[model samples]
Target: MWSGDELDLDAYLERIGLRENPLAPGELRADLATLYAVHRAHTAAITFESLDVLLGRPVALDVKSIEGKLVHGRRGGYCYEQNSLLAAALERIGFEVTGRGARNRTRGDSLLAVTHAVLVVTVDGEEWLCDAGFGHQGPREPVPLGRPGADVEQGKWTYRIREEEDGVLALCLLRGDTWRDLYAFSPQRYHPVDYVVLNHYSSGHPHSSFVGRVIVQRPGDDVRRALVGRELTSLHPDGRIERRLVGPDEILTVLDREFGLRLPDREAEELVGMYLAGD
Candidate 1:
């Protein structure tokens, strides 16, 4: 179960630019509208990155640690940290949040391991797929579950949930004229301990994509951007992708200016060193 009780809800709301508390008297309701607003605000504010793994640090999943790093420390994290913090906040807000494990279908024909973490929130007997972790190409708002072939438009991007075999569901995005699969998940419910195991592989294993690479992404409404290793790719809604290589001298500035991530002096130097050494 997500440790919702341990989360500081007020601080989290403020971190996501919700200055006034939503839970104030007559201010908010734990419904679909509240869920959409929080989910959109969270994805817009916090970026998706895995800097700690490259720095040889363990990515902690506890709510307190996550708040310290993401909310207060002004940093970004990968899927596990991002979605865990989101799950806790949603749970604290009295939403029925269920954790799930998803496979990375974007990789290719080979079936990948279930390493991605997502959330399903039920409101008024309706389930919505609320994922705040899947980087730039991720959906900004909740996609209605059990409604296959229904296109949910969030800003300029469009997404749909497609039904697959064995009751699996695939979240697809509209790219030009094609609907591309982002990721897929079974109906199996996952717990916090399950993510702990998945996070171990993603954050530490040599074969993991987060290992020895600088991966940072921001899911913008109009243009989504991701910085992987040295290449910076900007994706537009019209299927136009602009990619450029970021030199070592410009990495920190790019992170700050583009992704809104500014590391401390020590970590900055360490990250630059890693980039220089080709780690």
Candidate 2:
């Protein structure tokens, strides 16, 4: 179970900018429309970042810890933290939510380990891929699992779930003319404990990509932006990318202004020091 009962539902909803929306149909319901709205709003409000991992801090997967850091503290997190919080919210709202472990496919033909966490929600007998933690190029709304290979449009971005061999589903994004694979997941259901294992490897292992670098991503309707180490890349939907170096002196400023992430003074100073030392 995802410990939905322990989560502060009001605070979580408010953090995602959904509690005050006038268009909400009375209360949150276990339906497709509500699922779509929650997914869209969550991905828009919370960013995808690995700051804590880079800072050598343990990434906790408990709903309460996640709610405190992400909802109350107004900080961002990577896949496990992001999707775990989301799964708890959806489960609290009475939807059928489950977890899936996925492998990153963006790094060409390399066979990477399954480290990413995603959620599957079932609404009225229809299943949807509700992943709010896939970083900048991730889908803003739920991708239909029933209809694989169908193009689903979220704002200006297009995404599709392709059925691969052995009951595996690959999530792909349209980059201009190419439908590039983002990640792939099998049918085996993963639990929170499984994520804790994946989180450990990702947050502390020397081979982890998030272990030694600053990685932050925000998906937008027009342009998606990512800050990796000292380089900031802005990706447009038309396959155009603009890259620039962010100096140690301005890293904190860029994080606050560009990514809407303002860390505490002490953490900010430490991060700057890391960049200054070229770590």
Candidate 3:
């Protein structure tokens, strides 16, 4: 429950590379331009990570703790923390934002639980689907929820919104010649406790990907950077790709140098060592 005062708007704006303005949400147009700038700036600024879960660090989604870790401490988080922070920042700017949880259909199983958070932002009666938390395959701009089949291109990547007969909307990314589902979401708003439940499962469950490996990602100039366990991938604009496996000794170096995350040296060493050993 963000009361709008929990997040320091000035600190948040500076962290996300936006200038602080006294304009209220009503004062600024919720048009595509404003949405795009904010969305891009945010995705560009923060890394999508789950290192705390690996290190047994208590992850809290409350506004105060979120500000301390992400905005102030300069660490990153997974879906819940990322979206919660994004929503708070949006509310501060006067965007009519609602927190919604979605099933990750990217793995091709519709039976998956609601583990991802997204925002349905309304401005001037028009609603757009926004999720800056989706790591490498996420949209850099908002997807107009009204327009199905519309494609959003970032560099060489193409994304679209697929609406099913049951009224569920799935964000899809084109992979090679096929369209891959990113996630399935609905219009229903979710409460804060819902995320607490999902976050617990995501962070603690042995079957969850977060617990199984070390995942880190951050947006680059025209590339999207992602590190899965020891594999680091750099997806480029023209579809050319570069891939490398980081050695055990260089785990923290890769995380810090590439992802801009500076976990304590001892913790980074132990967490990565533990993860590899467990795997």
Q: Tell me how far the alpha carbon of residue 174 in candidate 2 is from the true structure, in angstroms, after superposition.
A: 0.3
Candidate models: Cα lDDT each = 0.90, 0.91, 0.80
TM-score for candidate 1, residues paired by index: 0.97
Clashing pairs in 3: 25-94
**Cα lDDT tens digits for candidate 1, 169-218:** 99999988888999999999999999999999999999999998889999
**166-220: candidate 2 lDDT, tens digit per residue:** 9999999998888999999999999999999998899999999998999999998
Error of 1 at 47 (Å): 0.6
Task: Point out the worst 10-residue segment of candidate 3 by lDDT.
Answer: 21-30
Off by over 4 Å in 1: 21-26
- Comparison by lDDT, 2 against 3, better one: 2
In model 1, the number of clashes is 0
Across 184-229, the per-residue lDDT of candidate 3 in tens digits comes to 8887888778888989999899888888577898766578789987
Top candidate when judged by lDDT against the true structure: 2
Clashes of each: 0, 0, 1
Judged by TM-score, which candidate is best?
2
TM-scores, in order shown? 0.97, 0.98, 0.89
Residue-level error in angstroms, candidate 2, position 213: 0.3
Candidate 2 accuracy as lDDT: 0.91
